[model samples]
Target: MTAGTVQALVVCSTASGAVTSAGGPVSCGTDAKGNPLYLSTVQAYVVDPASAGYFDAIATPFDYTQAFGFWSVAFTSVVGLYFACLGIGTVVNFLRRA
Candidate 1:
């Protein structure tokens, strides 16, 4: 995807139950044909706050791909702000009677 474009993708869970994805674009650690790696590995661990050690394990399992969407409306808002500020400033200056 090009810059300024929003892309969405599903990310699996990590050992700490955290998920991560590169965001947008079906590229990243893919095969030669541009296919996803399909690496769905779940991680489980029990942290020992005192000893800072605990039991941890991982299971490689594929999960459903969570569909995400992205849209751009900030540009429109920025343009609107620009014209609004210009108009307001002009009005204020004109009414100042200076």
Candidate 2:
């Protein structure tokens, strides 16, 4: 494995039996073997207004290998669409007399 960055997310359960997420996506550094060193013992806390202490806890367990996937046509399609829209907008703006 090689050293790199990985993505993580946090899911929390409040004291009032409410479930929420604190992190949609956060970047973390990996070790030389491309292992998420910090995810080994990762956790997060949240605030619950309905609770006494108004706090919650989240378990942030993730696998570095599970973070990566094979590059697919979806990426290419999105990039293509972006550039296509930009080019169309530029041409439309340039041709406008106003």
Candidate 3:
């Protein structure tokens, strides 16, 4: 298959779950039960040279698994700061009325 094109591979198997012929084109032979075999697809992406730098700049240095903990900690810190500010405002209002 050409670049950026998806290609399907048809795999044939017997009734006992044994593979017969694999890696054939989309129009593959039937299985032992006279039924069509399963089809697997493969694709390749061709990126333009001009856009490669843009993609690199937007890509994250850390994977999602590592970023999850960092985001959770940041969220908790923001919530804590919000409550602290609220508490301070309440105390200031109480003193101003006294």
Candidate 4:
């Protein structure tokens, strides 16, 4: 399906004989066998304007703060590990010399 029409659909019937779509409601009818039936139809849309981006090209304001926190935690962990390795190497070198 194109950008307009729904690609797939799912139908469900409750114990109370009520049928509902994913969220929308369609027409109800009865078949020749006298069973309640619900029909879901999809129509093609020639134009959809909501897909267009109306916000700015840059990231959201909150995302900038989140990114900063993420990098700060990452760099702090990296620096801690670097110092740990350096201390371990110094201890090993001193032991070898002794």
TM-score of each: 0.28, 0.28, 0.37, 0.39
Model 3 agreement with the true structure over 22-90: per-residue lDDT tens digits: 643343557666876544443436665666777788884868877898999999999999999999999
For model 1 the local lDDT of residue 35 reads 50
Deviating ranges (above 4 Å) for candidate 4: 1-62
Candidate 4 lDDT (Cα, whole model)?
Answer: 0.59
- Cα lDDT tens digits, model 1, 1-98, are 12132334344322222233574333236556665554343433434444332222234343434222112356667889999999999999999977
Which 10-residue span in candidate 4 carries the lowest summed lDDT?
A: 10-19
| Candidates by TM-score, descending order | 4, 3, 1, 2
Per-residue lDDT of candidate 2, residues 1-98 (tens digit)? 22233443343222122222374323245557665423222233433344423223334565555554324456777899999999999999989955
TM-score leader: 4
TM-score of 3: 0.37
Q: Compared with the true structure, what per-residue lDDT tens digits does model 4 show for residues 1-98? A: 23344343334222222334566554465567766656553333432344333333333466778899999999999999999999999999999999
Better of 2 and 3 by lDDT: 3
The residue-level lDDT of candidate 2 at 47 comes to: 32
**What's the lDDT for candidate 2?**
0.47
Report the lDDT of model 4 for residue 45: 45
The positional error of residue 74 in candidate 1, measured at the CA in angstroms, is 1.0
